[model samples]
Target: MASTLYKWAGLLFLSSFPYIFTLRGDFVFDDTEAIVKNKDVSSESWTDCFYNDFWGTNIKSNLSHKSYRPFTILTFRLNYIMNNRQLSALSFKTTNLFCHILSTVLVWFTYKIVVNIQHLKKHKIDISYFGALLFAVHPIHIEAISGIVGRADLLCGTTFFLAFICYDKAINSQKHSSLFMVVTIILSAVSMLFKENGVTVLGFCLFYDMIHNIKNKKETQIYKFCNKINMKRITILMLSIVFLLYGRWAIMGGTKPEFKATDNPAAFADSFTKVVTHSYIHFLNSLLFVWPQWLCYDWSMGCVPLIQKFLDHRILCPLLMYLYGIFIIRAIFCKQNKKFTKRILLLSVALIILPFLPAANIFYPVGFVIAERVLYIPSAGYCLMISFGLNKIITRFNKYKLGLIAYIILLLIYGLRSWQRSYDWQSEYQLFVNGMLVCPLNAKIHYNIAKVSDARNKTDVALASYKEAIRLYPEYYQAMNNLANLLKNQKKYQDAEYYLRSALKYKQDYPAVWMNLGIVLASTKRLKESEQAYKIALQYRKNYPDCYYNIGNLYLEMKKSENALDNWLKAINFNRKHELAWTNMIALLDNTEQLDRALQLIPNALSELPNSPLINFAVGNIYGKMDRFEEAEKHFLKAISLFDRKVQAIHYANLGVLYHRWKRYDMAEIMYKNALKINPDFKTAIRNLISLQKYKNR
Candidate 1:
C-alpha cells in the first residue's frame, strides 16, 4: 500500500513539475478568442454557454466556429467568477495545470485497470507506472498544458479515462453491471460535451470488450471474436452513442462547420494530392510522438505543402509508417506472443487509433491542419506502447538496470523540452516568435506576430509582418483587413482603401472588413459609400456593436444627429458595456440640450462600465451641463485617474471649462496650461486660456 501511494505521488510530481512554469504564462494564440474576449466565459448569464459556440458566438450563426463545448466554457466561466469577474491568466492556467494533473492520475488508474485485466502480473516491471510516467513528462502535451484554451482537451481526456474505467467495471462486476454501464454512458456524454472527439471513448469501450472476449476464448479466428460477447450491454452502449451523436447533430443545427482552404489545405486539394498529403500528415503526427523536437502552436497556412506528385519525398514517411503499423498488427496476433502481450498491444493500438480518427481528416475537415492539443488523449496510447516496448526490450536483453537508465534519460530529455516549451507560451510574442522559428513559411504565424505587434503599438513591425503574411498567402483576407486598419491609423487612406477592397474580394461576407472599409471610406470623404458599407456590415452581423458604433459615427459625419443617436443607442443595446457607444450617445444628447435625458442614461451605463474612462468623462460633461459642479469635478478627477497611461488633452480642457463656468479663474488657468502641456497645439486649451486671461482682468 505504501509503495502504491509512493508511485502515485511520483506520478503526480512528474506530471506537475515540468508544467510549473505554465502558472506564469499568459493567454496566447486561440486563448485570446476563447477566453479573454469570449463573452460566454465571462458573462454573468452562465446559461449562455448552452446557446453559444466555444468562442461565445451564437452556435447557429454562420460566423460561429461551431465548436460546441458548453461544459468546457462553463469551467472557463467558473474560473472567471473565481477570479473576481476578471480574466486572470494565472487563474485560468492554474485550472489547466490542475486538469492536466488530474488527467495524468486518471491515466495511471486506467492503465492499471488495463494491466490487471490482461493479467500481466508475471512482468517484473510495473508497466502501468511506466506508461503513466511517460505520459506525465511527454513534451507533446505542452500545447495542451501550457495554452490556457486547451482545457477542452484536458477536461475531455479526464472524463474519457473515467468513462473507460467505468466500462471496465461494468464488464467485471455482475452485481452492479447495469449501474456501471449507466455511469459509463453519462461520463461518455460529459466527455463529448467537453470536446467533440471525446465521444470516441465509447468506441474504445466497445473495442476493449471485444478484446476481453477474445482473450477469454483464446481464439484467433475473426468469427469467434463476438461469440461470447454480451449483446445486451453492447446494444445499450451502441444506442447511447447513437443518441449522443443525434443530440450533437441537433445542437449544431445539422450543419457542418465551414472551413477555408487555408485552414486545411489538403482537404481542398485534388483527390490524388489530398490522399498523399493527408497520409503524409499522419506520418508527421506520428513523428511528433516519436521525436517532439520541432513543435509549433499552429501547423496551418502552408506549413505542410501538398504532395502533388507520387514521387514526392514526403510520401515515403507515410509508407514507412503504414509498414510499421502492419508489422505491429502481425506481432500482436503472432502465436509465439503471450495472450497478455497481445491484449496490451491491441488495447494500445485502439487507444492511439480511435481517439485520433476524429482528427485524422478522414471523416471531415478540421479547422487546423495539425493541433498538438488534439493529441492529448491519443498520447496516452502512445505512452503505453512505448512503455510496453521498453519492457520487452529490457526482458529480452536481460538488462533491467541499463533499461532503467535509458528510461530515466528519455524522461529527462522530454521533461526538459516541456519546461523550455512552457517558456515559449509565457507570452504571445514569444510563442509566435518561436513558431516563426519552427515554420517560418507558415502565414498564420506571421499574421499572429502582426496582431501582437499591432496591439503593442509597434506599427512598423506590424505593417511589415502583415505584408509578409499577405505575400505568403495571397487569399489571407484577415491579414489584409488588419493591415488596412494599421494603414488607416497612419492616415494613409488610399493605401488603406486599397487593402480593404482587396480583402473584400476574398471575403465579402466578413463584417469586420466591411466595418473597417466604412471607416476608411468616411475618412476619404465618401460619406454615401461609407454608409452603404456600414449597412452591409450590419447586414452580415446583426448584433455587431462595433459596426453599429461605426454607423453612428458615419451619421454624425453626415450631420444626422437623430440617426447618430439612434445607431449609438442600438450599439449600446447590443453591448451594454460598449463605452464608445454609451459616451457618444450621452454626448449627443448633452449637445442637443437633453441634460435630463443624458443624466437618466448615466446610471445604467455606469453600472455596466464603472471603470470606463470614456463613460466617466461623458458623465462629467453632463453633470457640468446640469450645473452640478461638485459632482462634475469628482467625475472628471475619476476619469483622469482611470485614463492611467496618458490623460487626453480634451478631458483636461473640458474640466478647465467647468472651472471657468464656476468662476475659479486660478484653477481654470492651471487646468488650461496642463491641457496645453499634453498637446502643444492645443486649440481648445489655447482659446480657453486667452478667454480665462480676459475673465481674470474683469
Candidate 2:
C-alpha cells in the first residue's frame, strides 16, 4: 500500500512540474467566450447560468451546446468563485494541472487492472510499467492537460479510464459486480458531461466483452458470434429509444442553440481495403504519441492531406491486410495459442478500432480525421498491447540492462516532447502561433489567432490574419464575419458592407454578422438600410438582444421615437441586464416628461448593476431635473466619487450648483474648483462658480 501511494505521489509530482511554468498564461481561444467573458456564470444565479439559452449567451451557452458538458462548467464555476471575483489566468490554470495528475493516476490504475486481468493470455509482459510511463509522458496529452479549460478532456479521459477498469472488475466477478456496473454508468455519464466522445465508453466495454467471447469459444464459435450479432442489434434498438427520449428533451429544450479519399479509399477492393486504409492512418496518429514530431490542436481545413503519404510508399496497407488474414486463419485453424493470449489480441484491436468507427469518415467525414483527443480512449489499447509486448520481449533478453536503456531513451524522448508541447498550451495565443508554425496553412489556427488578436485590440494585425485565413479557406464563414468586423473598424464602410454581404452569402443566417452590418450602416447615416439589416437579423434570431439593441439605437437616431421605444423594450426583454437599453429607456422617458416612470426604472437599473457609476450618474441627473436639490447633490457626489474624473465632470458641476442653491457658498466654491481641476474649459463649473460668488455677496 505504501509503495502504491509512493508511485501515485511520484507520478503526480512529475506531471505537475511543467504546470509551474504555465500558470501565468493568458486565456486561450474558447476560454474567452466560455469563461472570462461569459456573464451568465458571472451572475449570482447558478441555475440561470446552466439553463441559459445557448444562442446569444456568452460562456453560459457552452453548457447547453455541444453535449452540455457540465463537468467543465462546474470546474470553471469553482475557479471563478474561489478567485473571489478576480480570477487571474494562473488561478484558473492551476486546476488543469491537478486534473492532469488525477488523470495520470487513473491511467496507472487502468494499466494495472488490465495487466492483472485473468483472461490475459500473455505471460508477464513486464513492460506494463514502461507503457504506463510512455502514456504518462506522451506529448499528445499536452493538448488535454496544458490549457486551463482543457481539464474537460482530462476529466473525460480520467472517468473513461475509471469506467473501463470498473468494467474489467465487473467482468472478473470481483464480488461487487453490480456495484461496479452502477459506478461505471455514473462515471460514463460524467465523461459525457466532459465531452461528447464520453458516450463511446459503453460501446467499447461491450466490444471488449465480445472480443473475449470470440477468443474463448471454439465449439460454439459460430453460434456465439451469431447470438452476439443479435445482441448488438437489440442493443442498438434500446439505445435508439433512449436517444429519442433524450432528443425530445434536447431538441425542444435547447435554450440556445469534408470529403477525403486517396484514390477511392471507398472504391477500394473491399471492407478489408477501407478498414486497412483508415486504421493505418489512425495507427499512425496513435503512434505519434510515442514519437510526436508535429503537434497540432486542429489539423482541419487546408494544407494537410487526408492521409499521410508514407503509408502508400511502404506498402503498409498490403502488409496489414496480410496480417489480418493470418489472424482470421489462426482463429479458424491454429489451436496452438492459449485462449487468453488470443483474447487479449482480439480485444485490444476491438477497443482501439471500434470507438473510432463513428468518427472514421465512413458514414460522415468530420473535417480532419487526426487529433490527439480522439485517441484518448483508443490509446489505452495501444498502451496495453505495448506493455504486453514489452513483457514478452524482456523475458527473452537481458531484462535489466537492455530493458533499462530502451526504457530510458523512450521516456526521455516522450517526456521532452511533452514538456515542449506543454509550453505551447500556455495560452490560446501560444497554442495557435505554435500550431501555425507546425501546420502553417491550417485555416483554423489563423482564425483562432486572429480572434485572440482582435480581442486584445490588435485590430490591424487581426484584420491581416483574418484575411489570410480567408485566403487559405474561403468557405470559413466565422473568419468572414470577423474580417467584416475589422473592415468596419477601419471606417471603410462600403468595404465592410461588402464583406458582411459575403458572409451572409456563405451562411445567410449568421445573425451576428447581420447585426454588425446593421451597426456599420447606422454609423454611416444609412438608417433605413440599417433597419432592414437588423430586421433580417431578427428574423434569423428573434431573441438576439444585440440585434434588438442595435435596431433600437437606429430608430432613436432616425427620430422614430415609438419604434425606438418598442425595440428597446424588446432588447430589455431579451437580456434583462442590457445596460444600453435600460439607460436609453430612462433617457427617453426623462425627455418626454415621464418622470415617475423614469424614476421607477432607476432602481431597476441599479438592481441590474449595483454600484454602477453610469447608473448613479443617470440617477443624479434625474434627481437634479426634478428639483430635489439635496437628494441630487448626494447622488451626484456619489457618482463623482465613484466614476473617473474625466467622465464625472458634469456630476461635479451639478454638485456645485446644489450646494450654491442651499446657501453652502464655501462648499460650492470647493466643488466648482474641483470640477475645473477635472476639465479646464468646464462651462458648467465656470457659470456655477460665478453664481456662487454672487450668492455669497447677497
Candidate 3:
C-alpha cells in the first residue's frame, strides 16, 4: 500500500514539475475571449453558462460559436469567484495544473486495468507506471496545460477515463452491475458536457466490451456477438446516447456553427482536395505524438497548404500512415500471436483511434486546422504503445540496461521541452511571436502578432504585421478591420476607409467592422454615411454599447443635442459602466447649460463606476461650473489619484482654471506648471500659465 502511494506521488510530481513555470503566465490567445471578456464566466449569473456559448454569446444567436461547454465555464467562474471576482491567472493556471495531475493519475489506473485484463505476468518494468509517466511529461500536452482555456480538455479527459472505468466495472462485476451501469451513464454525460469530443468515450466503452467478450469466448461467428453481450445494458447505453445527442442539438438551436474558409480551408475545398488534405492532417497529428518538436498556438490560414493534386508529395504521408494502420490491425487480429498480445494491441489501437475520430474532420468541420490540446487524451495510447515496445526490447533482446537508459532519456528530453514551452505562454507577445516562428505563412499568427503589438502602442510593428497578414490571406476580414482601426487612430481616414470597405466586401454581417467603419467615416466628416454605418452595425448587434456611444458623438456633431442625449442614455442602459458615454453625456449637458440635470446624474454614474477617473473628472468639471468650489476641488484630487497609469495634462489644466476662478492665484500657478511638466507643448497649460502670471503681476 505504501509503495502504491509513493508511485502516485511520483506521478503527481512528474506531471506538475514541468508546468510550475506557467503559474505566473498571463492568459494568452483564446483565454481573452473565453475567460477575461466572457461575461458568462465572470460577472453573469452562474446559470447563464447553460444558456450561453463558451465565449458568452447566447447559444441560439446567429453570432454564437456554438461551443457549448457550460461545465468547463462553470469551473472558470468558480476560479473567478475564488479570486474575489478578479482575473488571477495564477489561480486559474494552478487549478489547471491540479486537474492535469488528476488526469495523469486516472490514466495510470486505466492503463493498469487494461494490462491486468490481458493477464500478463508482472515484470521488472511496470508498463502502467512508465506509460502514465510518459503521458505526464509529454511536451505536446504543454498547450493544454499552459493555456487557461485548455481546461476543457483536461476536465474532459478526467471524466472520460472515469466513465470508461465505470463501464468496465459494470460489464465485469456480478453483484454491483446495476449500480456501476448507473454511475457509468452519469459519468459519460458529465464527460460530454465538459467537451464536445468526450462523447467518443462511450464508443470506446462499447469497443472494449466487445473485445472482452470475444477474448473470453473465443467467438469467431459474427451472428453470435449480440447474444453474448448483455443486451439490456447495451440498450440502456444506446438510449442514453440518443438522448445526449438530442440535448446537444437542442442547445445549439439545431443550427450548425458557421466557419469561414480561412478557419478550415480544406472543409470548403473540392472533394479531392478536402480528402487529400484531411488525410495529411491525420498524418501530421500522428507525427506530433511521435515527435512533438514543432508546436504553435494556431494552425490555420495556409499553415498546411491544401493538397490539390494526386501527385502532391504530401499525399504520400497519408498513404504511408494508412499502410501502417493496416499493419497494426493485422497484428491485433493475428491468430499466430498469443491471446494476451492480441488483447493488448487491440485495446491500444482502440484508445488511439476512437477518442481521435471526433477531431479527425470526418463527420463535420472543425474551426481549426490542428489543435495540440485535442491530443491530450490520445497521447495515452501512444505512451502505452511505446512503453510496451520498450518492455519488449528489454525482455526479447536481453538489453535491460540499454532499454531503461532510452526510457529515461526520452522522459528527460520531453520534460525539458515542456519546460521551455511554458515560457512562450508568459505573455501574448511571446506566445504569438513563437507561433510566427513555427508557422510564418499562417496569416492568423501574423494577425495575432499585430494585435499584441497594437496593445503595446508599437504602431509601426503593428502596421507591418497587419500588412503581412493581409498579404498572406487577402480575404482575412478580421485583419483588415484591425489594420483599419490602427490607420484611423493615425488620422489616415482615407486609408482606413479603404480597408474597412474591403473588409465589408468579405464579411458584410460583421458588426465590429461596421462600427469601426462608422468611426472612420465620422473622422472624415461624412456624418450621414457614418450614421448609416452605425445603424447597420446596430442592426447586426443590438446590444452593442460602443455603437450607441459613437452614434451619440455623431448626433452631437449634427447639432442634435436631444438625439445625442438619447443615444448616450441607451449606451448607459446597455453597459452601465461605460465611462466614455457617461462623461460625454455630462459634457453635453454642461455645454447646453443643463447643470442641475447633469449634477443629478452624477450619483448613479458614480455608483456604477466608483473608481472611474474619467467620470470623477467630469463630476469635478460639473461642480466647478455650478460654483461649488470645495466639492470641485475634492473631486479633482480624487480623479488624479484614481488615474490608471498617468494623469493627463488637460485634467491638471482644468483644475488650474477652477483654482483661478476661486481667486487662489498661487495654487493656480502650481497646477498650470505641473500640467506643463507632464506635456511641455500642451497649449491649454501654456495659455493658462500666461494668464495666471498676468493676474499675479496685477
- Give me the candidate number with maximum TM-score: 3
Instruction: Put down candidate 2 lDDT per residue, 352-417, tens digits, no spaces.
Output: 666566457565444354666666656666666666666656766748567667766876777777
lDDT against the true structure, each candidate: 0.90, 0.69, 0.90
Candidate 3, residues 1-698, lDDT tens digits: the string is: 99989997889889999988899899888999999999988775879999989888999998888988999999999999989989999999999999999999999989988878867686658998999999999988888989988999999999999998988899889999999989988888898888987887888887787777776665455533376347677777778888888899999999988987888999999999999999999999999998888999999988999999888988999999999999988987788877777777778888988888878899899888999999999899899888887887798888989999999999999999899998888889999999998899999899889988999999999999999999999988999999999999999999999999999999999999999999999988899999999999999999999999999999999999999999999999999989999999988888889998997899999899978888899999999998899999998989989984589888889999999999998888999998888899999889989987987789
Residue-level error in angstroms, candidate 3, position 62: 3.8
The TM-score-based order of candidates, best leading, equals: 3, 1, 2
Clashing pairs in 3: none
Off by over 4 Å in 2: 1-6, 19-27, 31-99, 116-126, 146-156, 170-284, 303-348, 363-369, 388-399, 589-597, 645-698
- For candidate 2, the per-residue lDDT at 134 reads 62
Name the regions of candidate 1 deviating beyond 4 angstroms: 44-48, 57-66, 218-229, 539-548, 551-563, 585-611, 618-628, 676-698
Error of 3 at 306 (Å): 0.4
Instruction: Estimate the lDDT of model 3.
Output: 0.90
Give the per-residue lDDT digits (tens) of candidate 1, residues 125-156: 78889999999999899999888879999999
